[model samples]
Target: MEARLSKETVLKLSTDHKFGAEGNISTHKVEFIVDSDFGIPGAVTVVNGYDNEFFLESITIEQNFHFACKSWVQPKKLDPEKRIFFFNKAYLPCETPNGVKELRERDLMQLRGDGRGRRVCSDRVYDYDVYNDLGDPIMGDAYARPTLGGQHNPYPTRCRTGRPPSTTDSKTESRPSESELIYVPRDEELEDTKQETIDQGKLMAILRNIMPAIIDKIMGNEEVFDIDHYIKESGQSEFNSQLPLSRILLNLGGAVQEFFKFDPPKTYSRRRSHFLLDDEFGRQVLSAFPLSIESLKVFPPVSKLDPSIYGSVESALKEEHIIGHLEGMSIQQALEENKLFILDYHDVYLPFLERINGLEKRKAYATTTIFFLTKMGTLNPIAIQLALPTGNPNTSSKQVLTPPKDDTSKWLWQLGKAHLLHPHMRYTLKTNAISRQTLINAEGTIETDYTPGRYCMQFTSAAYKDWWRFDMEGIPADLVRRGLAVPDATEPHGIRLLIEDYPFAADGLLIWSSIEKLVRTYVNHYYKNSNAVSSDNELQCWYREFINLGHPDHENATWWPKLANPEDLISMLTTVIWTVSAQHAVLNFGQYPYGGYVPIRPPLIRKLIPKEEDPEYSDFVKDPQRYFLSSLPSLFQATKFMAVINIGSAHSPDEEYIGGRNDVTSWVGEPEIIDAFNQFSMEMKSIEMEIKRRNADPKLRNRCGVDVIPYDLLIPSSGRGATGRGVPNSVTA
Candidate 1:
């Protein structure tokens, strides 16, 4: 039999055997029939069947035969010359295939390189095939050999060759490309991107938190930006090292500045202590105390008490609780009663009195008078009358004074009367005993007197003289005698009487008497009847006979010269005419009359004296009475006094008057009356001064023991209008 060589066999022989001649017969040919499943037609070759055979030429194997070929009878090794042998299948008999018919050339051609055939070849070659069965290739018949140039397998020459046969039979699975296999870099790179976003968010948050703080810093309120330091310190940490601390702080500061740019400038106030001992007072007191003493020769004594106690005393003095003991009492009594009252031992009184006297230089006598009267309580009645303009009783009335029914009226009237009688009286009277009873009725059951303490009396030297000499020569005696002069019996020929005896004990008696006499005289002169005779019978007779009988118009009748002595009437009439003519002259000619009714008074006598030494005295000498009496006319002209007296058959008439006319017309024309009263006041004031001077004689002064210098007296003229603007002077008379 001839050996047939497959392509695999050839490849194996080529690889295993060399071309060197060893032992083979010449001109030998071997042929093998292969099944179609084995290979393609040209793929097989003929070769010695045994390993000992060799040939010099290419061997060929038949496409569909299975046979063996050898050159020697026994598979001998031939010399190198006999190695090439030819085995011709044509010489062998044509026989049918024994077991299974071999494939033909064309069929073998179809089987070449097929995965099924390759698999069969593997099975036939090896007892058990390691190659997988190829039931159906995954890539179907279009499978191509894998190429190494790309991603395909390089070893396998067919599509199904590299894959396991079962894999190929299952289903086609998609292989991933390079890009799909490469995953997103999720470790450090992704973390970095996420961290960057967080850092940006954190920066924005920090900026928002610190913006306000920066604004405050720029506004000069550094405390508001205290967090900036913290932020800087925080930024220095490793975690925040990259943060721009200075830039961020600057930005925040700028934002703050912009926010507060419109704010007003800050104001700073130096602290001050209200304590008087502080720096301000220390300097002031030191300078003032020394300078004041040097200038005025007066130093307020410093107390020996502790400063705290001195402070308390200062406070008490400021509050008026430490009034000098002499305020509401006679100087002698104040000196004696030191323990009963808080005294301003500071001796402020003399200086105050000097100040008051200085005011007199400025023609501020009214003000000075008011100050003294107020301190002494003598101003109370005037103050009360002013406050209740309608309630006060008539100043000229002799009737019992009746106060209003109201408690306030009663209290005020009593207080005013007490103050008037005794200017030093302090306690306000309480007529409502229930009020005092209530106090006594309190839980303590203590007994307390409703009346206040002992009353103090204050009187000017002039007042004392006038009051003491009432019966002897003052207004009381004058009024009691109905404008008559009386003799002083004690002085014998020293005084003469022009009128009968009249009692002048009580306060209102003199004023009332004067008012009555004036009313009687004027009414009698006008009505042609005796004003003093107002009995019902008398009035009836006069009314029927004189008034009702049209023949004699009694109501309009004038009795200018009938009732009074001609000389006295002429004198009175002359005084009135002179007063009117003087007024007319001043008004019309703008100058006073040169001489008329000049009295022989001291003021006038002083004016006539020649003063060569003092300028002020020279000026006074030129017109001393004029200087003193310049204000008197105006004062008297404004006087308004109320009177209660019998008139027209009634005990008292409702008629009010300016002077004496019962007609309302007279009341309406009060200015003239007031002017007359003011002039009279000036005369009275001159008289009062004379009286004081007379009483200050050596004899009287020796009798009084004390130096009887008149306490600066203020004789309030009746007609001068009230001081303190329109407020009635009587309000605090």
Candidate 2:
């Protein structure tokens, strides 16, 4: 066998010899010659060394030679016999890349040799008509049914060059020749043809089987080929109630998927979410529930005891653990009144007051929260009464506006409409304790709901401000004279609770609601103007300006120096909102009686129980007032951490929760979120100090109903009370 090596192969060999073990061990190597054209060794010679011990030298050289051949030995042209044999041998069968063996005849047909190559005999062996007698090539299956295009006809004929083929030409017709014509049909064939008549039923059935597919293809495979056809054919209009809300949502989601891709652009968001604004859906949900008083009647207070409180003051506040016990007898009375007391909002009033003020902003914030929580199924029948100012101040009492007939009706009113108050009224809205208690009673719901039941709400402007104030005639006569029995201060006014005291406070929810509104504002604005916001910087800039961060007229804003970098500020703000919302959730729905019940003992009687003393300490355990007052510092600390979280998750949009998931599936209040909160808390030393110093001031603490002990200690350090293990004691120093 003759074998040829490529230039690379020879070079490789030389490279191996020069660089391998053979090169190292050998001593006969003399010179290396590389071909200038091919870059390979042209010649190599290894001569024996004169003083070699035993090895002989190797010499390799390239040489070329040619000899004249005798005249008679060479042929002038290819011999027929020799050329034929050689051609046959050279054209031997071989496997093609397609794995098919190539035939000699087929291979020969593909080649031409200057019109001098011998024609293979087998090329003409297969005698078939390539053209008709008229010399035009026959095309397709001429034996099948005739077609207008001659390409499909079995027979073919050349057309006259001067003009198109005439219909009058017998050759142009598809009729078969005399020999090919059928004269009579066989009995079986006749019967078969007779039975082949088209059946309407079968044709319709076949069409029904294939029509959908044909329509789908025509419609680009859309699920709904025709909306009217689908609705009418499927009887969808009559089966509306048969579909579950979840199924509807899923269907809506599917429709949304069809239009807007779930895959967000290569931006920060992991997934796109659709948020339905408060509208008919909100109303429908509210309409499904009973009115506040009625709901209270139907869904009675749970018999379960309060959650046991444990952890340090900071941890307790941050963790939202229970602290002290409420006097059972008095609790029963308050429960009868359907009044649930909330201490956090009332005791730590400064932060909220600083963050949110003014009737308009407060109304917007409160309304937004109510609607949001209502959607979350946390609050129930919410009654909001806004008195539209009538031009005539002397309008009859009968003409005065009243609270909505029910929450569903309240839902019918728009936010702007709900903010309008009677000119004579002083407050935004007036809600009774029954509705507030409804919220407290529904704390440990399985659904993870945050909405409270029906509450009386009123929207007013300044007419009755003094009546609702904490000083002078405005103070609730019962609260000042009987509730606390504290002597009226000589001075008229300095600082006081803005509203008359209720049996319970929804301050956490109130503040949380504000945060919730702010969060929604940002998120909604982000989505609404998502197209305009192409980058993180743009989004932050848009939000800052939109929220009116530094504007003097803006009510909802940061009090401290604003972060110069909008991106940082937006991120921190998002984190704050997410963290606060989650924490508020933990406060409201994560446990039963998150802060324990209000004390039943009168203030005078509770004071009688010595501060440092014994068995009676159980009766005098820390109240919500003390718990909230002490937690002010920790609350501020938590706030700072929230800022940290915002900053951390700024660039990564997927890190923060959008409004897609409901309460149960939401990322809020999760352990990871809490961990993030804890991580940032340690960095807020100054904020915590300021909080502590302010809360510790004797005058302020006294005036604000603050306690002497630290917020961490629910029970007196000197004595034991009704203590039960609850939260893991993971308190930060």
Candidate 3:
């Protein structure tokens, strides 16, 4: 028979047995007994001697109310609260009960055994009440209700056979119906709970892996973060504010200087301001970079750099200049060397200096006159002229040489002569202050000495009114009028007389230097040689005729012997023809004050120079008639001419003549005339070429090279409808 054990005796035995083998036990198994009063299998609590629970296993209580027990030994001492209680019997009858037992009567179950010591012992009898009715009993809660719904018996229930409830007999009872259990949960509430669980998991993982440095920064750790310096250093404002002026100038000057180093470069250099006072040096620097000593001193001092050092730098700037530097001495030594200074001045310098006292005052007048003329003409003559008095040289009652009243008139006449005699003198007037002044003061007196080889020139004015007087009164009328002379009506009258000389004898020859010399001579002779008061129109006429005829071949004729060759004659003739034609056009069609009309005729000698009467000669002369006619239609149809000839047949006879009301047809109807002229000019050009070719061929004319095309035949026609009335064809080599 099994021994009957009270609950107190069982509890005491469990405690004593567990403590006695505490160190010896390597492994232990615990079991629990079911309490019929609680409808649960009561479990044994495995604990240390100090009453610290370690584990629990379930056993069973029989219908007679005896305790069944099991035991466990801990590997290490556990916390009293963490121990688990296990029931040795299945809770449900449907569950298999492999280890179910009655807790009241049992043999001494071996709870723990020492593997190392080879020790085995029957030890603790587990207290079943600890698992069944102790504080917070395992497997018992309000949420968990039994599936077997009826009130359970306080003592162990009988098995299905009405025998003692053993492990096999307990499973034999009819299993509780599955429908007896119930559960209720809100779907939405469950989903929210699940989402919160996932979020918490992610947050914990992130926090665990984050670097301490980054975490501290995010967490407002003052020692790890900085913002003040970063904000201040983020923009361009500070960089822009500190830019220096000297650096800008350096960049600009460097750019300009580099640009000037190229051949055929810009007229102005980058360092133009720095070199402003040195005209020659500026030009040299612009052209080649480093300037020679001779060129350097011309400019005023703007820097403290020694001239020699500057020269060295300048020389290095130009590849060619370097060679020159090397030829003298080492480049360094040459740069340092100082030679005797020779103050060289351009004609512009003196005039510039004169206005220094009051630059504005001088700039107002001197700049417009002297500077302008210097640029237009040459510097020497303008300087001399500007230096001269504004009045006449008085010698006696019979001799008074007055300064020229019509400067432009004299200049234009000289210009015309120059164009006629020396067509190669095509120098453009410089547009400096002096030239501007000359242009502005174009009406001023232009006195010149009379000489054989001088006459052709032009001048500027210092003011608009002066320019007007020259343009309106002097240029197209008195000075350029063909075969006519008109004296200046204003104060300080001066005469302009042309002379026939070698080169100057040619039509269209332009000898600019000769023109200048002639004007100079006129000034000198009138003041020194001639009795200025003599109003000998014959002498004037003789001079005019001599000029009009160009140079003569007659020996001892006043200007005949001066011509060097027949080539000179052709050149002069060409120049004269061009000048006269230009003048005629200006006077007849241009806006001159005289209503585009001038009372002038062709030179009598020009008219009287008898043309060949032969039909062949006339044909040759008229060969450009086709071209002339062809050009006329367009010329006459122009709006300007139409405006000029707007008056109709009802107008007065004088007006009618001017307005194209004679029996003659309108200019637009004269195509045939222009065609004839064009054909004639073409033929004339052909003939001219043939003559030149013949002259050039030594085999044809003993190499004498005489121009046989008659001067009169070469002259352009004056009549509107005539052949070859305008510009002739150009000659080419």
Candidate achieving higher TM-score, 1 or 2: 2
Worst 10 residues of 3 by lDDT: 598-607
Model 2 TM-score on a 0 to 1 scale = 0.17
Which tens-of-lDDT digit does each residue in 76-95 have in candidate 3? 23323212333322232223
Tens digit per residue, CA lDDT, model 2, 288-325: 11111111211112212112211111111110111112
lDDT of 3: 0.23
- Which stretches of candidate 2 lie above 4 Å from their native place? 1-595, 598-681, 685-697, 702-733
Sequence-dependent TM-score of model 3: 0.15
Winner on TM-score between 2 and 3 is 2
Q: How close is every model to the real structure, measured as TM-score?
A: 0.16, 0.17, 0.15
Order of models, best TM-score first: 2, 1, 3
- Model 3 residue runs over 4 Å out of place are 1-345, 348-568, 580-733
RMSD of each: 66.5, 36.5, 58.8
Candidate with the greatest TM-score versus the true structure: 2
Q: What local lDDT does model 2 show for residue 244?
A: 96
